[model samples]
Target: MDRHNVELNRERPLATPTDLASDAVRDIGAGLNGLLADVFALYLKTKNFHWHMSGPHFRDYHLLLDEHGSQIFEMTDEIAERGRKLGATSLRSIGHISRLQRILDNDSDFVSPEDMLSELRDDNKQLVAILRQLHEMTSSYNDHATTSVIENWIDEAERRSWFLFEMTRRSL
Candidate 1:
């Protein structure tokens, strides 16, 4: 056999053991996985509110929810890519998200705007907390890039949650 062929045969698969190494990379990968789940949950919740929102503020709330959903969905893809870059598997499917997500599904049949806002606020707060925790872990592992990403995400989630809370409070 040609030497090149032999070398190719000896190469490890992208998903194999050789692709995995570095404690900092592993920490970033795990954090990215968890962050992906949270982003997916946030996307779904925003879409739910966008689809079902009613009352006097329906137009504004619908638009806001849709925007929020899009933002979260974009973040989901970014985090998944970050995971792959970290030499880890990215959670790309709904099944993977469900398995990894800490946030509970919102399955209410008839949801009030207030209820939706409250749920979103709670979920965002939870996401922010998780991201901050993950940031700490990643920082300990010297994964500065991943830590920075999570920190930005946490800030965005917290701001969105506060906005939603304020809107709901004004309505009350």
Candidate 2:
């Protein structure tokens, strides 16, 4: 049978168990959606920087951006999976991402190493802020799994942002 045509012969609707567990799941889903949006935006910006970055620190900055991009990409997948675990569909497309994300796009053609580092630092900081908010929401809902994931991601992002800032400062 076609997947779309295959239907379960059940008498009742499949209610989401998370609804009974608590409103925390719903709240966590919402926060995770927001966090996913931010992560996607940051991922794009990091890749852009990786491609366009130039200076005495070209090689180093490029490598750093690539690593950061990979981390953000992994976080995006984790957040999306969390959304699914909470009984909702994950928003994984560019349109969904653009609609939900709050981060502004950097459309400039060529970006200096300093500018790239600054942008990444700002993006990471913003991500950390969003993660912190999500952490509070998850904690309120008593969602330990989601809270722990958010905490780890927040710490990593913050550390990366601080390192980027320090590098920029030393370059000055």
Candidate 3:
């Protein structure tokens, strides 16, 4: 192969064969990778809060965060695999994830339990919006499998948000 051909090949490795067209693969892959990055960021933040939890609600808040963290982490593998199945390369490293992730990180030395729950609730709502957008795009391409998976994720995110919201709310 000529130098130009060699460089092109290196940059765009042969994609795994799939029914998705090149455009669909490109668009969906990019979307999935971005979502995956956000998921990782959120998972870590959830864990951080869980570890740092204190005060009267320590046990309850810690356990809630642990459960939320696990649920967030569970989506990472499926998201990456789905991208690969669509013939698109997924996130390769922490640096790559940092570059693509939209979710903000919390690095404070101390975040109150209420604040942690509130932030996570907002983040989960943000995730639901992203999932909804991806679902619409995937459906437009007739990618029913990806859309179905996203639907379940959307429901899960909403539930997480609901729990977080309730935890932070004042008793009436």
lDDT tens digits by residue: candidate 2, 1-172: 5543344213213323454264665666777887888888989988988998887788888898899899888887788888777765578588988998987789987777888888788888888888888888788777888889888998899889988999888665
TM-score leaderboard ranking: 3, 2, 1
Which pairs in model 2 have colliding backbones? Answer: none
TM-score, one value per model: 0.86, 0.86, 0.91
**Candidate 3, poorest ten consecutive residues by summed lDDT:** 8-17
Q: Which model is ahead, 2 or 3, in terms of TM-score?
A: 3
Clashing residue pair totals per candidate (backbone < 3 A)? 0, 0, 0
Q: Tens digits of per-residue lDDT for model 1 on 1-172? A: 7987567557724432333346666677777887788788878878988999999999999998988888788797788877776767777688988988898888889999888988898898898889889888877876677778888888889888988889878665
lDDT of each candidate versus the true structure? 0.81, 0.80, 0.92
**Model 1 misplaced regions, further than 4 Å:** 1-12, 15-21, 170-172
Task: After superposing candidate 2 on the true structure, give the runs of residues whose Cα lies further than 4 Å from its correct spot.
Answer: 1-16, 19-22, 170-172
How big is the positional error of residue 58 in model 3, measured in Å on the Cα after superposition?
0.7
Residues 5-25, candidate 3, lDDT per residue (tens digit)? 677668777566678888999
lDDT of 3 at 8: 62
The candidate, 1 or 3, that scores higher on TM-score is: 3
